[model samples]
Target: MPSSSVTISSKCTILPDRNSPIIKTTLKLSVSDLPMLSCHYIQKGVLLSSPPLPPDSLIPLLKRSLAATLSFFPPLAGRLSTDAAGHVHIVCNDAGVEFVHAKAKHLFVASILAPGADVPSCFKEFFVFDNTLSYAGHHMPLAGVQVTELADGVFIGCTVNHSVTDGTSFWNFFNTFAEVCRGDKKISKSPHFSRDTVFNSPAVLPLPAGGPSATFAGDEPLRERIFHFSRESILKLKLKANRKRVNTEILGKESNDGWRAVNGANGKANGAVNRTDEISSFQSLCGQLWRSVTRARKLDGSKTTTFRMAVNCRHRLEPRLEPLYFGNAIQSIPTVASIGELLSRDLHWGADRLHQNVVAHDAATVRRGVQDWESNPRLFPLGNFDGASITMGSSPRFPMYDNDFGWGRPLAVRSGKANKFDGKISAFPGRDGGGSVDLEVVLAPETMAGLENDVEFMQYVS
Candidate 1:
């Protein structure tokens, strides 16, 4: 397809990573959907009890930081631009924030500034609608990020495109932002944006031109809408399932009684194994924990709905391959069954089904069938229906801790704040008490109330 040069700017404000061919591919595919996906970099600052720094004084530094960050990662200079025929393509330094616009007014952005600014409230308000680029993507940010400062507490945020980078990648740039602000040239790792392992199908058949358009119908059920579940609820459900046999009650023995009445109280482990040579011991443990949770659910269609975290294949798909793969490496693996269906079986039987889905996503299945899986809905059955729900989680096994910004550890840093969209789930560190993981499950107002009213959903109240 022929394309035109982008119109963001004449000068090359940003440059592409010379080593990344995948970056080239990402830029190419993003073109048709260009306007819909230009990335944004929002930098906010908090003033202490001293004084409020004028937005103008901040603008120069902000622009410099923005320019510096964009310099390190060249793709920021690129934009998905459209042509007269309405075909879109990528253009470097084509379009960017026209700060002169009213929407980009001197103080169009709200502040989390002390005495008056409320961080959470500001976030809620900003997130109530489509952000600056709302019309651009379904992944609208929290409407805006914030810079908060007060008597003792302090918090600053920057939220941007999920398509361009994962949560991990977002933090990568954020930490670097802090380093740059503090005048530290000591960056540990240079950014990687190569996607050698992620193969795009041909726009034609047999190949998966994996992108927004390639999304599968049946599998669409998984990503159509993802619902959040707190780790507390998961633990409660776990204990409820094992109430009869275990001494410690996550929900309570009575709760277990309710779970046990379903049917077959026992079954075989779903014959699945993930014993690859590269499987880290910790990943192996987490996998085992996931299997255990599935085992206890007893997905029988009436009580429990086993949940699974579908992983993006861009990173781990090929270890021998480069770390970066542009476009969506996101794959949906729903570890679930109809609510009524899950309640029919015992703990072990339910876990097996979940185990099967988990094991089914080995590198090869995803590599060999990525295109078919996303392109052929009837055959793969991914995007089959609308209003599907997914429960998401991450693996802490990868020696990946410390999202250390120059300020010290983010008193409490976490992602999964997806809002407006139905059935969205966000799980982070536990705010306080109990286990290592804390989950904040956000459902529709009705679904939340329903979960609250349901007998099976109220075990982990402590």
Candidate 2:
């Protein structure tokens, strides 16, 4: 590689004990690596500071914190290796961390590590690449945490394995490291890494495997797409659904006014929204969106829709389980729908059909199906999902904002690597349980343009 045309001090310092951890095992890595893919339209942000620790000392402090924290996180014993031995080096060079300022609706700064910083040469294969979006995500994470510097700024980016931990777990680790650095009293929440105790069976998804599509088709690199829906538009859609009658006891009867209006405008599919015993707020959203979107395009007569929500089966473990369990203990619950049903009238009442489809997996379904579904060589999921869209995501509820890690609430929570699947939607919290949902809608560029540019949708987006 050409010497960085952008020059900086070549002299770099390796933090203390950088070489201290002995590798119990290592995955052989190839220098030739696939380009890291970034289709996630959202970029979550957090402010990091190690006060009084100047640039020079920052490296040592971070490495020391990582090392000490590892004892508590034994799973990373051999998993977290460096590209170089001894130190997980830091480049103080100008190229090390860069920042850029731009004014949009508000002043914003973007930060990242330089593309080619001197990462440890001894690095293992796991940490160096992108997280695989293939169907059932991997339980093992490639802790390739890098502070990259982009043209505009410096930010921490990595391919965190979704199966190993959820966003809360990921940020939780960071907070603990910070506490360790400050020499705090103790890690507030004890982490669970005992695979046997923390994780239940099948360990993956697609129990029994086969059927549908084959092994995950190569993912089309993610394309940035946004869906514009308004707080009112959402409310309108709901209020018009099931008469003045609603589970409004939670959202209030006024909220369901839109459900009544929409049902009045287009009757038939309006009743289901009122029934609350089945599905969740998030799943209900998927079901509703699937119905609305399908109807929005049904004039063409040839399309289909499926609703899926990231379901946390952690509590579903046999005989019930504890509340503190950590790790990726969820799956995207797929709710099947035919285009005809989704697009037809009274989409609100029809929405419950989605609620009706979910069959939560028990131990039998998991052990016999999930494990075999993932490991079997002959089977995989289907790829030719024409006009099919999925909303695959776990809730961002578990106090992700509470993670101080000695820093503070993250300004944003981002998923750099999304599921390789197309037409995927991710959900995050809306300020303080007013029960808002945000989406990163991935779809073909043109189809998305049609929706985003639509006047009604623009109102929705705002």
Candidate 3:
């Protein structure tokens, strides 16, 4: 699709409904939120079948409901502020959010969901605030939504400041907006805005005069593709990862043979004593991806490869946060190993490594991570800095397909070209559900070609 194929019909700012009582206040940025200051806004959205009504009829309904939703999420309608100490905070002054209505009648849903098609470049144009960093929220809208009308469907794309919302909070706002559009009188889950649980003191961290620099290295051309693994395929991978193995002597010497322990405190694999614990489906799938991507890159055997998985800290903290806690509350836990060791190991070995790291990131470790950041705050080092790392964001467990705004459930979930770099992966629940998974993989062009042709990887892609 050419740029001329899509045209923006209208753009407006949406404020909270006047009927709702909204007080202007400031909300402190949590320890988890500070690192994202340099990151780009998260651009994600859903594709739905054509609505019963036309765009003119539906767009107004969406805008109206969005205003009501903003009443419940005051910070979203606010702007970022910096104090003399350079500490960033959200000022809830009803600054309003941007909403754009667009038309792309030439594009169809089939072209996007095609069996082995590269994600359409036109999808990026469906979102606003291209390349806008999160810190720009000081002047720009903290969030924006674009509704593009397709030939046979509609795409609702959203761009939100990463510092203010993680994948969890992003979906929470979307789900709530959908509910309001569906005429729900009561919010199923209200957001918790308290930052006390994130830290004790007013965790202050100053920033550079010009603000943090962008960490993404987009010099190399990249390819983005969505690989779907069916429910049965995921189950098969999990079963293989969990299959009982003979406690061979070789296993006992794993630690001596380049396999570093996941836990540094005890110099032993965390949760290794409970070998019977089942490997989660997520761990198994990610393990396969790590191995396949490594092979695709064709890196040197001695090169170190890292897989970073964003873990939700809300529940992992000592005092569990309210499930509805409404801000960034996630951290990336990296699992590292040499390419040779990772590729040579069995699926279970890699899966076990990922499982151990996740299990070891308990409350104490979470607190320690916070303290370390308080001591020295810096932006998240995103992108494949070493050309040998994969950072996985988003999750298959998020309620992605539930954004039914009077229209039918969404047919698929897609993302814009924000915060994308080589080795960046986003996971979404398969449209068919039932434990299925879809991985939106971004990689160097050559590596992607190799991955597409790799028999081992293609064999599991459904």
Instruction: For residues 328-403, write the lDDT of model 1, one tens digit per residue.
Output: 3445566656655444445444444554555566668666555553354221122213343434433321112343
Q: Which residue segments of model 2 deviate by more than 4 Å?
A: 1-54, 57-59, 80-128, 131-141, 149-154, 166-183, 195-222, 225-279, 292-303, 322-328, 358-384, 405-407, 431-434, 453-459
TM-score-better candidate, 2 vs 3: 3
Candidate 1 minimal-lDDT segment of 10 residues: 262-271
Answer with 1 or 2, whichever has the higher lDDT: 2
Candidate 2 per-residue C-alpha lDDT over 1-462 given as tens digits, one digit per residue, 9 for 90 to 100: 222222222222222233322224232211000001111211233323323444456445555565566555433332322233321111111111111121111112322222212211111111223433311121222343443222332233334433234544555665565568667867776675333532333221222332122233445643443243344445544443433334447356554433232211011111122234333333345555565445444335555566655444444457443334445444334666567755555545554555454333444443444454335422223232665665555343434344343444444434443344555565554433343445555555455545444443344443
TM-score of 1: 0.57
Which portions of model 3 miss their true places by more than 4 Å?
Answer: 1-4, 19-22, 244-276
**For all the candidates, what are their Cα RMSDs to the real structure?**
11.5, 11.2, 6.3
The residue-level lDDT of candidate 3 at 248 comes to 41
Give per-model TM-scores.
0.57, 0.61, 0.91
Give me the overall lDDT of model 1: 0.35
The models' CA-based lDDT, in order, is 0.35, 0.39, 0.81
TM-score of 2: 0.61
